[model samples]
Target chain A: MNPPSGNAGAPLLEFDRVTVRFTDVVALEDVSFRIRPGETRILMGAAGSGKTVLLKTAMGLDRAASGRVVLMGEDITRRPETELFDLRSKVGMLFQESALFDSMTIAQNVAYPLLNQKAIKMEREKMEPAVRDSLRFVELEQTMERYPSELSGGMRRRVAIARAVVTKPPLLLYDSPTAGLDPITAHTIMALIIKERDVDNTTAVVVTYRYQDGNLVANFRYNPNSGRLDPVGSQGTNTIFMVLRDGRLAFEGAQAELEASSDPYIRKFVKRPERDAA
Target chain B: MLDVLKGPVQAVQGFFELTGRAIRNVIAKPLYLNDIFLQMDSIGVGSIPIVLLTGTFTGGIMALQLGRELQQYGQTDQTGTAVSIILVRELGPVLTAVMMAGRNSSGIASELGSMKVTEQIDAMRALGTDPVKKLVTPRMLATNIMLPCLTVIDDFIGMVGGWVIGMIVYNLQSLRYWTTTWQALGWSDVVQGLLKPFVFSFVISLVGCYFGLNTTGGTQGVGRSTTQAVVVAAVSIFVIDLFLGKIFVSGQRGL
Candidate 1:
């Protein structure tokens, strides 16, 4: 079969048979998927099923032992880190643990990316507005001077989101952004993600265990006219679902198609409604 | 048997690899000089009290023991010369490095290890900053510069402690004791004292970073890395001193 293509042009991210291994454990095997520009792809999987590994692989944080990763129209599977800098500048990744620098205050954490851009050494005055804007975007503006250790779990995740998007990167990768949050906080984070997608036309790949959250992400579209999210059509082109089982791609399609899949593991995954995914 | 050797061999290779990367980053852009200054203050200033105590105690003890031993042969006057030579030639660099190996090496390992386990290092990379340059380089450079400076202070304080003991305990004339000590210290002794700490600092920094970057298994893994950093750095201090001591000894004999 031919590789997947975008509706407008080349796919923004394409994983052609990517495989990763750590000793005897196979983190990913023959994994393949594509996410087009401005499209949100939700990666669904059970624990140890390669959900987080796939996300890391896309960002070049984990090297694939075989196959290719085509990112931003460039094959970066084996590229050296120096060459990946420009590509990474266009991509923002939020880790599973809300990995804010513990020693830095919330503002410094948010401004780190902008200040480190191509080693340009940005001045504090220039960095202040961007940091303030990102903090306000995450609704954590009042906690700008607090260190990561001082923030609550949910607050740290929000700050992580702010830091990820502080530089206005076009592609956002979120690894379980709502994993440990309360319902209200999770909803808020999900809303902010959709807002980013709508306002910035940001393409994103989210790793999630909650099928309901994934459904909410895949089925909703933000309408600026009403300032509210509305459900997309049954055949919406904005979102896609990719499911993995035992480190291989088991299913990749719309939410309807996923619920209809006959594979027992896929069926089991669809059966569980509000469970946590790895 | 091969496996036993392999661990050390791989560790040595890893140390060299990190050192090479750190040096390249030193010459690269975005040096993170702020972190360098912060570390210099922390490692240099934070350590002054302990180093001071160690220096004074060590110097007084060296003079006291030497004075007693030499008096058995009616050579008590040589105690000051002996203490100055040992302090400048060996004790200053070795003791200061051992203290750093215990303090700064473990600190670096635990900090990096925690960052590794928590994904902050990975996040830094995703943000377009290199962890080696942003995190490790500043620390390595700071400790490298400060270790030598501390050794000089240790040596100077040690000489003064020896002077107190020489005058009060041994009853050596103050003028004679100072003259002999000054005469005993050649440029070679100063070079040896500085050179050892400079090299020892590299070993401590590189080993600490290696274990920290490779940390796994969780918080337990961080503890393991920290312990490994201190043990390896401390042992390496002695091992390196032994080899470097031989080199200086042979050179002196040849001269």
Candidate 2:
């Protein structure tokens, strides 16, 4: 039910022995994981290691051949398309390529989810402000009128992130949010993701290849407010850092545990590259 | 010779694969009539103006050319009968199908092809929605229903075009042209013209969507598939028309 209490309680999102097979290829095989409410779970894997497939499965984009994708205690497998729209509305996804509609302006792109939902039709008038607020949230308010083709790679990703979070979904799924960006820009995007999780109490599942020290530090913050996310030194905020590899839980527990991990893969993952390697 | 045979073999294989996919899709999820109606609006209603203009001009040109030739025998009065018969029985359906193949079939192919190239079709599948039901079936049903309707429109327009040329250029009376055309042409001529387009519609849509769904590579692949779909559909229409014409005309002569 809650993240900071460790893996004792029910998780907000759980994959129970999920498998995805495409002809001769098994994209994911018997993959299982759990992320409790208010957790920032990191799915780190090498390229072609099924991180994207895992994220897609959780988002209900990729159906598992066998097993269940339980979201908030409900098995969403075989859910009707109409109900899937509602499920999708509750989870926001940022694709690696941004995948913004080229025909739409930044504001229109951000407001897409709102317009797509019939339930939000009466609230259409509020879409503009929501778009503006989401853009402002990502620090891209001035680029609202620009098309996707007009934006830089970083700007486009931010716009995509803005669009994904515009509906203020409880779960935010990000596929390589900082991929193909410079180090500084990648850190900035990661910081924004951290800020969103803190401010909105949004549980985030980010699939990425980069493992930076600052990102690790950001993942280990402790705040005391509601055990979801509070400012550092706040009364009730607790953070747990996790890493998944080869479609399984590779490393979990406190930041100190990860730092002290003598496992070769964990050591290599946590090791800061020497100046020569850099 | 072997290399040339390769293309046909590949095409046949692709056709079989597409048919299998279509059958599986239909079994998985069936398309509704409302979708067919919307597609009819796209393939038929939306295409009417172009089909009319092209059919009329083709009819007029045929009449003008044939009129000049027939005047040598002072068989000019028979021009109305000849033009009406040809237009209603053969030219109308064939020409309309060819034009629709260029317009509606190619457009559908290109649009769907581009979506495939861009992974939008894959995106729909990932969302557990059948692209054939959502995209292809409606268009196919629409084309099947609308092609015959377009043929009827083409028949009406073609006759009017022949009448215009007969009255204005040849100094024939409009009333005489209509009476001669009506007396010479029968329900069978109209039925023959109408029948071919229904079959042609299926060929155009199936080939178009088939090529589109299987398109790969990038924008260039989409463009190539779109062009190939139109060419294949148009050629198949004429070939199919020739056979249908033989059957109908021979049956009538035997009668």
Candidate 3:
């Protein structure tokens, strides 16, 4: 597979023959996937199709019972928790519920990873600027001092995105970024995600169910000026991977290929349910 | 025969698993130092007043009862000695352990248990942090260190209780009471009483944290673990006390 633009060199992370088992259930089976240095990879799956487990394995939260998780060319499947900490510092996660610490304000939540960072000795001095920058990235600069409970769901998600990206990690993992949001708010969040990747060249692995038809069609257009294939239009063109039921790779291609796909699963995923189906 | 063999086999397996986890945790990072310090503040510092109050009252009651019994036999002078021996050798450590099992052990178990059920432990792991180091180790170290210190404090307060009852209530001379107590209580008794706490602390903390870390089924599991921790710790302390007493008694006869 051709590497995405802005990811000119080698792949930054890859899961080779990864298999995650939870007792009798196999969450992910023989899953092989890769994300380059600065590409956004979408992982699409139904509720229990193991999207969350796949993300957990990459984050080193779940052990790949039999395979290898290669990050920066280092096989980190069985690394010690301490070593995994260093690896995790280079990646950020935005959980489905935002998972903002209820006890902390938005600013404190954003500064949490920085506080845990062993590299930052002068925590008090460095914390404010980091929090400000992160909040600014998600356009949530004003709500820094407010608690998570005080914020709306959309605002909380943005705060979570801010916290996740605060560390300025090269890789970002987002779980259901637009699951419970109005279309406008979801679009706003998607735009912010696109902006972050374009401006900072950060690699994003987004797991979401919302697949806009217009966005998919526009993503197929090749930009001759940049010499890159845009997946979800020029505004957000990154690699996409879809996982289906029964441990099947339902779709694996650019936005163009996915838009043109005739597979029933892919069609069902991309198309809006008709009035009869609804 | 089958039941008997099955019980022993299961017990052995549990012991090995517990031992393996502890060893793995110790070798993992030694990150429990700060956590242990914080836990010491919670378990030892917080429980001081209650343990002291209970220890003192129990000692006073024992002294009063013993004094009444000895007075009938015209052996009233031995009341202080008897009270002191009981308080120092057994009652002080055992009572304090039970008190802490109710107060500190239950709290630790429930708090950690709730955090486990809520996916906070999973979050910690996802962040590339060891939950054992961050949550369990400090608690274990804190309870182990603080329980002994609390036992010593309880012993002192208990002795004071006996003195107050003997001198004021029973009209016994303070000097005579002190002399009898000092003569009857040897360094061996103190050492044996103190020794039990160090072992009891380890047992209480290990059991409390183990139950907390393994808790599931949500709020109900947290509640269940808390109750179980107290019962287990209290029972284990008594068992350890009996064995320690036998060892001391045997050693003294040999000496």
Chain B TM-score in each of the candidates: 0.95, 0.90, 0.90
Q: Which rank order by lDDT, best down to worst?
A: 1, 3, 2
Candidate 1 differs from the real structure by a C-alpha RMSD in angstroms, to one decimal, of 2.7
Task: At residue B180, give the lDDT of candidate 3.
Answer: 86
Number of the top DockQ candidate? 1
Question: What proportion of the real contacts between chains A and B does each prediction keep?
Answer: 0.80, 0.02, 0.29
Give every prediction's interface RMSD. Answer: 0.9, 4.5, 2.3
In candidate 2, what are the lDDT values of residues A1-278, reduced to their tens digit?
A: 11245445577788888988764678887766677777776666667778888888886767888989988677887785446756667777887777676756888778877766443452767878898999998999999888989999999889988978887888888888888999778766876787777678888887776666324424334233633322343232334555655655566555556667787876665656223211
Error of 1 at B86 (Å): 1.3
Compared with the true structure, what per-residue lDDT tens digits does model 3 show for residues A105-190?
89988887787755443368878998998898777899988998899999999998887887788888888888889977876677
**Clashing pairs in model 1?**
A209-A277
Residue runs of model 3 more than 4 Å from their true location after superposition: A1-8, A100-108, A118-124, A139-157, A178-191, A209-236, A244-251, A254-278, B1-36, B64-72, B163-178
The regions of model 2 sitting more than 4 angstroms off are A1-9, A80-82, A118-122, A142-146, A213-217, A220-278, B1-57, B64-76, B116-255
The residue pairs in collision within model 2 are: A223-A236, A223-A237, A224-A234, A224-A235, A224-A236, A224-A237, A225-A236, A225-A237
TM-score per candidate, chains pooled: 0.94, 0.71, 0.80
Ranking 1 against 3 by TM-score, winner: 1
Clashes of 2: 8
CAPRI verdict (incorrect, acceptable, medium, high) for model 1: high
Model 3 per-residue lDDT tens digits across residues B224-245: 9899888887888899899999
Report the number of the highest-TM-score candidate.
Answer: 1
